[model samples]
Target: MKLDFTLKRFPINGRLKEQSGLPFSCVLQPYHRLPEKETSAGDASGTRSNSIARCAQCYSYINCYCVFDTAGWVCSLCNRHNALKPQQQKRYRLDPTVLQELPEVRSEVFETLAEDPIPVPMPALEGSPAAQQDPGYVSGPAPVVVALVDTAAGEEFLELVRSSLEAALEALPPVTRFALITMSNRLGLHDVRASEPSVRYVSLLEPQLRPGASAAAAAASSPAVACPLSDVMPLSSLLAPVGSFKGAITRALEENMVPEQGFGETSDAEASGSGAAVGPSGAPGQEAAMSRNSGGDAAPGGGVGARSGRSGGGHLPAARGLGPALVAVLDYLKVLQSPAFASVKTPDSEGGLSGHGSGASAAAVVGADHLSQNPSPVKLLLFLAGVPDFGVGRLV
Candidate 1:
């Protein structure tokens, strides 16, 4: 329960400089109290109170570090005096019986109300469909999982993904939301919320090219044309409710696995046989034909073949377009977590500790970047088949 700082001199500006070029950091693990058992009468009044006392100036929670007095308590962090209410003063009285009974005042950690100190009301919808419904219908943010599958991924990898997703269905909470996207020469956005889930395609090949450009130009230009995944479909549609569309999503994964293509007619056959189905829009046998037509001549659909390099000599190319797909998903989530979109008021927002309390400090230290300032929670899960081959971090 004791934290020892190895640094003799603390950084006043919160920046540590070293000549070794490596950042100085320290790991801190806070103390946690065990849960108490219930009583026979089910009246847990003897246990710690639901409400927590906090400093008025810094809003820091009352912990063992705080110095308690008959009139008020002194905050350790900000060194500010906080006057205690009549009830708090009585609870922390000097009597031996009260001191023995109320251990929460002396404990480093204890249970309290799970609610936000300051609550923000959601903006009212004027003309939307939901506006006519119950005025009190409040929609909290749902957990989101986005799976980015590589088209260049082999049949084995795709099969593994399918199995993992199936397992995830049983493990993930019913209220969780899931989205599936595929990357290769192009990006495929699967709208699983629809009655029949289908992938909408977006070409990664750049549009601008000279009259007599070579096949290499196609590969070089594709990164420029790659658009955000959110543009293909709204986030609401892409992130389908797992509880309602688990079956539909499972079927989409089974039917829409795209394989490495544009190698040649022979390799295309092998890819199809290995369970790599053509995109949702294309027919079963059309992928091979398109690959053959696009491979020989750069004039017709050369962009496809060029963007997706040939798997010549029976060697499959590394996955392509993963970087763009990831970027798109990240951008979408960032916007979702922004203050503009997270307008809904949840129970946690109305009942928890203030933003400056120990709760906020813990969250800020744990995952400051991932956790949004807004009360709504956002989660992202990425599944990669292999290294990306076509973007800033491409291996080649």
Candidate 2:
């Protein structure tokens, strides 16, 4: 099979381009025939391995482009040197078959990994959005859809977003839960279960933020957002059930969300020929692309669930307080609790987002490994109609 692209680059000004724009989906046909020399498994079907080598930093699968050495291999994509396990090192020295059998090393295009995510019993109130649950009994991991709306994106552009989100709402699985956040110099968290369209505004600005750094870093560096995300809205309310609360979500998008004047060029700028380069990358908006972080293992579950996707939070000029908000969200999910994210204190029984946050550093630069690594994947869709001209990561 042949492949093509829709965009050119992935990141824009230290921000994740997955939230940039366009569709970059890959349809994996497991039953398709493989090229003659491509299959190391000696069949038309590709290699089936229980384990695939992955970069500890970026969580990307190791591919043919990696440079292998005596100690370990350097990730071709992130250029981070990942040490091989002792057993893996021994296997590399003793048995040449290990390298020969790795699908990532053998095929440059594709490979099938047979990962068996433990199947959980469907929750009793599955798809019943209005259903309440035992506060203590957390269900399995459910796919989280956080739509970060740029409130400054005028009515016309927002209308397009409204329709698109509505269409996406129809396609979502019954168990999926979604969170809505509106940004334009400040942050607003929406509770889908509220009687009316309820959005609590949050100021996430820190006294000082180093330029060209991610929001994740600022949260790690200084005092976090004015309040925790749950403080703005509880996790239970944040992740509203798509099945029952579909109408509520649509209403929240419409009712009182008026566009705020921003510092960037108008929507007409793109049509009039603005040459800011954007690329087609498999990002959180696309479920499949979002799952790439966890070896594509987490089947979009919730509570007691762990998955990883694109990490680090980008702060737009129009979206200022976004960093602390995301850190709060990740804290709610316990993303940092995973060893992959950081080496934190042993979490006690009490569960809540508190001090010593996990995500990025106190530095101006956001490292690739200092991001969403494993076991907690949150799909964040940043809806922007124009380049941000206000805060950090501004196009200007």
Candidate 3:
């Protein structure tokens, strides 16, 4: 399918006389819904003779081009995380929406892991038991609850994410509990039980995750619990807890440890060696903790996600750690992509590109943010910031 493409310039933050801006040059990739046709490969000049390259207002790269019949492609410089703000002279940049409304435009809309188990009982321990339970069975294990916390996403994006997750979960046999948390220093968790089941905004213990805050502040404010994705409670019973979620889980699990007894010091040495906090944790390929804050808390109470909190100030400094984020995402994706969580049909399976032909997959949209960095899990976050810009194109 030949999808449409357009360029939209976003304002960049800048000081006097200096101009800065990030341009989102977007292309609507061919999806199942769009019509299909073979694309004529670009000629020697890197583009068809009929197509022309144009400067995207927000990007510094000159590669932004408008093609006659193909998905759009943008330059890397303008769409990065550390993109700078534009200067005063460049302030009144062209809006992406206007460019998209051009004559030929067709209006369209769009949009892991398992771990070892611990023997634990639910708070509702002594109930009437199960219909198919043993004559005198004490209790069965509590079902694990997987709560996904997406940071910096806006309301629409968060809702879309929530819906996607729910859709993904539908394919699973049956899960005990599941929740969603959206954070950005502040918190917004949806009430899973309410009649309308809407997202509730909460006072995030940390402010650093907000767009302007530093990374450090965000890290510090992040909750250690896996429950209630945000800090909103009194406002609603279905509160989302915010803080170092992975930490809380780790800390809770570490409380109970089994001492090792080995025949030789070599075995003992290896056991001890494995437990130390060596260097930094959670680098993409490195087998570190799934979360930066909670290396010690992979397994804890019923595995449903819990909570513990204390308010703090300022944004956490940009830690030189990405491994944990990568690990967290990979683990999450493992579960998300699992047979249990596979709700939507994959693009590749239906014969589009690899896996995004319907282009319904979240990774397709998220990939635009980080695929250029290195084709690993690090790219998952760029879209987590979920600020709406142009769809992903030629400026003119």
Candidate 4:
């Protein structure tokens, strides 16, 4: 691939300081295949082998950029010389025409396989239970999908999400693992794999607050608590096998109705007017409306808008807690995509129950290895119905 840079001379120094007028960024999608190479695997010259020419210092694969001579090859990345093995030397002595036919020597991008005389058995490390339970480990990484829905949105928005998720389920391969999360004033984790699937609540504000103290006191005493997504649920439980839990997932989506108050108050004129009249604390009329909306039965004291009286705890009148929610989910996605973090074994009990112990970790390692060797491919699909009005990047 050709690289175009704004600077006249390449910045050889490792430090990448911000330059006033220089556009120093480029986005390339390597995985996107050309029309001709879409169906085919390009050249067939590259094969898997135990040994291959690579950079001694940087470990970069031997490619068209490398300089080859009688003694050794010079790595283009680090400019280090790597001596050729006996077999490599013999291959180098072949006819010029035969050497040209080799994909690694000619093509910019080529495939390779590890040389394996006998398949090495996977080791069952004692500390990592995730690697011990599942024996039917696959060779490649299965795709993963995480859905973050804004429960503060309107009925129309929720309906659209339902339809979109249904379509997504149909389009995704059966092997794909999926997880669902919802956010309003707080975050909700839907455990679809449970015997009786239900939405587990995670209080975004309370967790950050001091026990028996007000929300204001918490904010005053300490910075907002950063809750890791993994802490919300075990990694094994959070992601469910889509094939088996499709129905449960659909039900979770269907049941995600807007809360009576909080951010959802804007959905109804009466609630909004009442909210306005009562200011940020939430009005009696709004509470009554919320109660009536729930089949004329009063919502429990700890229901939505209960903490509106607390400082910084009022119902979000305009844009809800979209910013923090998105950040949390995005952080979780980053963890999922990271090889080192994703491959870490879960507890033995957790792995045993999920039946994905060593198998899952192995898949993660393989996926990570593929990503490290090749350009990592990722895509983020965000579904939003309103503006982000909480924490950083708030528009309203």
What is candidate 3's lDDT per residue for 10-59, written digit by digit as tens?
34434421444333355655553532222222112232322222235553
Candidate 2 lDDT, tens digit per residue, 1-396? Answer: 423345433343324545665564446555676676755543314434444567899988776667787678888667798988764565444244677665566566554646668553343353344243221112345566888877765568878888888889999865566777777666666655543444455555553567997665754566445566544444544566576577777776765354542324443322322222222222111111112224322232111211132211122324434444455445655532354322232344125322111111122111211222434356878787655544334444
Using all chains and alpha carbons, the TM-scores for the candidates as numbered come to 0.52, 0.49, 0.22, 0.51
Off by over 4 Å in 1: 1-50, 53-61, 67-102, 109-139, 204-225, 262-318, 338-376
Superposed Cα RMSD, model 3: 22.6
- Where model 3 places Cα greater than 4 Å from the true spot, the runs are 1-139, 149-163, 205-383, 386-396
Specify the poorest-scoring 10-residue window by lDDT in model 1.
357-366
Each prediction's RMSD to truth:
14.4, 16.8, 22.6, 11.6
In terms of TM-score, which candidate is stronger, 1 or 3?
1
Q: Write the per-residue lDDT of candidate 4 for residues 1-396, one digit (tens) a residue.
A: 223335543343345344444566754555655445522333533566444566769988776666777678788756788887786776655456766666666765555665644332332332356424332222235556778777666667778888999899888755456778777656666655443344444544322545798755654554221456555455445665455557767765665334424444453333323222221222111121122134323222222233232112334443456656666666655645565323444355344432222123332222232222222233445677777665544566
Q: Clashes in model 1: which pairs?
A: 115-351, 115-352, 116-351, 116-352, 117-352
In model 3, what is the error at residue 259, expressed in angstroms?
Answer: 48
- Span of 10 residues, lowest total lDDT, candidate 3: 304-313
Clashing pairs in 4: 48-113, 49-113, 49-114, 49-115, 50-114, 50-115, 130-357, 130-358, 131-358
Question: Comparing 1 and 2 by TM-score, which wins?
Answer: 1
Instruction: For residue 163, give model 3's deviation from the true position in Å.
Output: 5.4
lDDT score at residue 80, model 1, on the 0-100 scale: 89
